[model samples]
Target: MKVNKKMKTSALAGAALLSLQALPASADQEYLLTITRPGHLQVIDMSTNEVVRTCDVPGKFGTGSIAPSPDGKIAYVLSNMTEDVYGFDIQTCDITFHAAQSQGNVRVKTHQSITVSADGKELYTVQNPVRHLPDRFEVMEPQLAVYNTADGTDAKPVRTFPVDRRITKIAATEKGEVILGGADIKAIDVNSGEVRMVTALQSWDRGPEWLPPDAFAMHSQGEQSNEYIMPYVTAKFQDDTMNMETAEWWWGISRVDLATGEAVRQEIIPFEFIVFNFISDPRDPNIFYGSFNTLSKHDITTGETLALYEMPHTYYDLNISADGKTIYVGGTSSDISIHSSDTLEKIGSIQLSGDMSTSDLRVATIRD
Candidate 1:
């Protein structure tokens, strides 16, 4: 995944440098985990299992992952069909920002993920772009843009680095660095705007167990050579009891070191296809946490995977407490569950008014 050493200078010349000086000190933080289902954002309070409020979103409940600013004041929602990203004020419940694609040669086909910088000045959006013109071998490139937060306006493209492969996930590191992964993971220098393929990850070999039992977890590779196709239900299982139930199905977790272009650790996490959206131990950058049906804690330094917690089955999204003491998971096996990060024990669970489905959980901590 390492870039050619010769291209380093040209790639990162005079890009905006990341500033964490303004970032507030970490403290006991609470968050609202939003899960999408029929067509609502189930806002669950982490401190107490209570539906503090339910916000109505544009598309289906979970059109795309939801992200809150580090300060916890603003939340951004993306749409699968539209090119615009919506902003919500957590305190006033008002839509403050409506960030649209202001500049670009092509229209964004699928709006994937929206991440914000640590200083809360910019919103980084990752999207797929297609040329407006027809067939001339027009390329479909992975687009990245930085939108100003002062006003819900148009975003400008900072850099559109070439990634000819599939990018399934995009995340902002604790230090305000952007990490993109699909069949492979790449770390882009936020300040310098240099994108380096961090680690090369090979896709799982397809087989019978990879397909779903009732057509719920069908797997397919689009556009690429129709060389491999399998159902998603045939996912590998660790805990057989939960594996029998469709509610518990997850791919796995892998973390790569940006300094070195290699995967430090990887584990086959049980549960449905769920993307982790929370920092496990914010104080210690190496420790992070996430869940789908089961909760996990991974240490990138030592490359160790530990079963931190598990649920009754249904688990959608999660966010870490500001201080990294507790994890708030959105959904219902029977109810929404909150677990202590240190002990990995269930502290509380509460039922929500909305039904939870297979949706990626996005969470952000705000200083209260």
Candidate 2:
């Protein structure tokens, strides 16, 4: 179904009013937040399956990574070709915070590494910087920049610590630590800035017969499950005589608990199809959903394919509702397709103005 563009302004004004009034104690509402190209932040009410507000973003869109506050009031967007981050009040569509990672001669980019703390007090991102010289460009070290949420529009990093390069996604844990995905999954203490390995990806000790696993974990959709999940592909020699014909390809998952920092990495099933992103069900821990050219539901514990449905097009990211009843898939196109989590059937869709590209699809729960 298509959203009415004429309701944009009026809906935003109504949302602002609702933000000021006290909501019912037991009333909880869920909304889907995402960005579209040439710059727009769209928020859709999950109950009615309609676009509520379309907030215009400040800079050029790139990856369009977003992190909503713990209370689900503000959405921090990584835009301006990943060189700048802006926080928008989803209720009023106001720019509440901004941070430009690029400086005089150096250009910085955060490749899908943006998140808010569990307490909603700080925002964190890993900045990969490069210095532009007269004749060439010099690659600089990466740093983890932290900013206070109360700093307002002209925000700056409160502190920064040197971190390993190639970090793509980050999530803050309840223990005041941030889990990072890179060559290996690592955890950094927010207060002490001490970095430690949570689990090994490329350096996994899966014996010399197995090759290093290849992982693509750019999407950040761990909020609903309260766990960071990454899907990986690897190969292993079938016998003592390592030969091309005697090898087996496999699919594995590396999951980290966002609340307790516990991590588990195991090969769930053999390599079957390409999956760009995966999210665990909040209601049922053993059930998980993945999206790409197809939508798949699997039982991670038994390596069983519970259901599979071919999608209309490829989707880069997918997220589930807090209740785990519905699934929202978007990224490649301008439409966010909704599906039934139980049956994997198409139920509805919300069409946007522009393509989402590599933008994130996030679910937010707020009081109404």
Model 2 alpha-carbon drift over 4 Å, by segment: 1-25
> Tell me, what's the RMSD of every candidate?
16.1, 9.0
Estimate, for each residue in 96-135, the C-alpha lDDT of model 1 and write its tens digit: 7775553355666433456666567777766666666665
Question: What's the CA error at residue 266 for candidate 2, in Å?
Answer: 1.0
Q: How many clashes does each candidate structure show, in the order listed?
A: 16, 0
Which candidate leads in TM-score? 2
Best by lDDT: 2
Residue-by-residue lDDT tens digits, candidate 2, 18-123: 9867565566778889999899999988889898999999888879899988899999999999989999888789999999889899999999999999999999
Q: What local lDDT score does residue 33 receive in model 1, on the 0 to 100 scale?
A: 52
CA lDDT for candidate 1: 0.53
Each model's lDDT comes to: 0.53, 0.89
